[model samples]
Target: MAEKYLIGVDGSEHSRVALAWGLARAAERNADVELLHVADDSFLSESVAFLSEAQQASQQMLDSETAYAKTLGFTGNITGTAVVGHPIAELEAASKRVDLLILGAHSGSRFAGSFFGTRAVKAAATAHCPVAVIPKHEVSPGAGIAVGIDGSEASKVAIAYAAEAASMRGVPLIAVYAWMAPLTPGLEYLWSEELVEAQRSAAEEAIAIGVAGLAERYPDLTIERRIVQSPPVAALVQVGEEVETLVVGSRGRGGISRLLLGSVSHGVLQALPCPVIVTRATA
Candidate 1:
């Protein structure tokens, strides 16, 4: 069976972009797409005098979205569901039975914070499968694929998943490693040429280790290695501008100190122009 793409849409502009992206991807892969709109009763009180009218309006919106999905060439099997409850809960439950979950970073409302607001962040962190966060702006074609690695077990899993995706897409896999310099303030001025060369050599060696490991598993896969001297999030966003997808481990050597999604992952998801895939280390 072909993979199923589940997209969450809430009538927001960002969600509309996500719907388009998911449909396009489904069309390309010849897969089915499911459009879900969760209606939380908590946000809409039953005490309202026009509750019946509100429900009717919501149903009409869902019908229109369903029709829009069909117009986008999702002929295989397109479904639009309206459920009463929390948006994140509904989406998370739906993800358990689907191959992939595509979500919008943020809505157009001023109440919504960054791309990965509280709800989206929680859903992405605990979803059963891979979740791709789509940005709102129009993306150019052929952005390639970028993967972040830190020589940890979790990062190894991320690299494997990224390698397969890049191979399947027939695109170059850019393996990026971001490291920080020593704490010494005047290191460059104090250190001799030999020290600088040694540091450079060490950095190259670490990057080579990661590349060698990947090459052993995927001998035919084409990959490019980049070692940048900066924070992981900064380096990733700088290189991610030209990548179609950015794949990263849900948790890496940095561990959970940064929170459920981690600061770097959250930052990349918020700023990257392309879709960001956060893969589970165990799955």
Candidate 2:
């Protein structure tokens, strides 16, 4: 079966970028693309007349987006849908039926509603499948793929997804493990250089374990392992700046807090470095 990708469209520049990105990926993967536009009902009273107007507006927006998609010249199957409801709730519900959900980063437009901004983060975090947040204009034309690793089941799943993506694109994969020395309250004076070294060693081990068999699995793929001594967000963002896509777990191990969807994922999104794919562990 062909893969399916759902995209949230709001008739904004950001959503247009997302639609373009989704269409490109769909063509490469021979995946189906679904464009969704949700009209915010909260802005109007629940009167029947108001609801009717919202429905008409929603259809108009969907029609425009559908027409826009055609202009892009995508030959694959494309579906356009519009609903009069909450964007976040509608996207979260639709995400379960698709392989991936793609959305554009928030652009501070009230017309965009929940398709971007903090709501986009919330949707990505709670979605049932992997969510890709396409930045408005920060994608590197032909950079490699990168994934954050921290010795967690979530990170492992991310590694698998990133590896497959890199292999498909025939691009190198950069696996990064960022670590910082653990600090104890009131024990700051006891901290020593030895502790820092120990932490560095552990970070290296974590990344090694995280990508143990990638080489053998993708013999033709070039994998670069990076062990950085910076905070996870900073490390991932710096790497993201130079990569085509940055893949990270929805949530990671508590100790490292390297890829927690709530904090780390949110932080990376704020940077808007590149297209970030937040993958959740499968059941």
Among the numbered candidates, top TM-score falls to 2
Residue 140, model 2: lDDT of: 72
**Candidate 1 per-residue C-alpha lDDT over 1-283 given as tens digits, one digit per residue, 9 for 90 to 100:** 8889888876677877888888877877787877776555555666656566555665666787788777776667787766555666677689888877888877445421222465666667767777888888776555568888787666676788788877767778899988876668656577677876787778788767766766666676789989888889999888888888888777622334323776777778767557888776663
Cα displacement (angstroms), candidate 2, residue 154, comes to 1.0
For candidate 1, the lDDT comes to 0.73
Q: Worst ten-residue run, lDDT, model 1?
A: 107-116
TM-score (C-alpha, index-matched) for candidate 2? 0.93
Clashes of 2: 1
In angstroms, how far off is 179's CA in candidate 1? Answer: 0.7
TM-score to true structure, per model:
0.82, 0.93
The residue ranges of model 2 lying beyond 4 angstroms of the native Cα positions read 110-114, 252-260
Clashing pairs in 2: 106-117
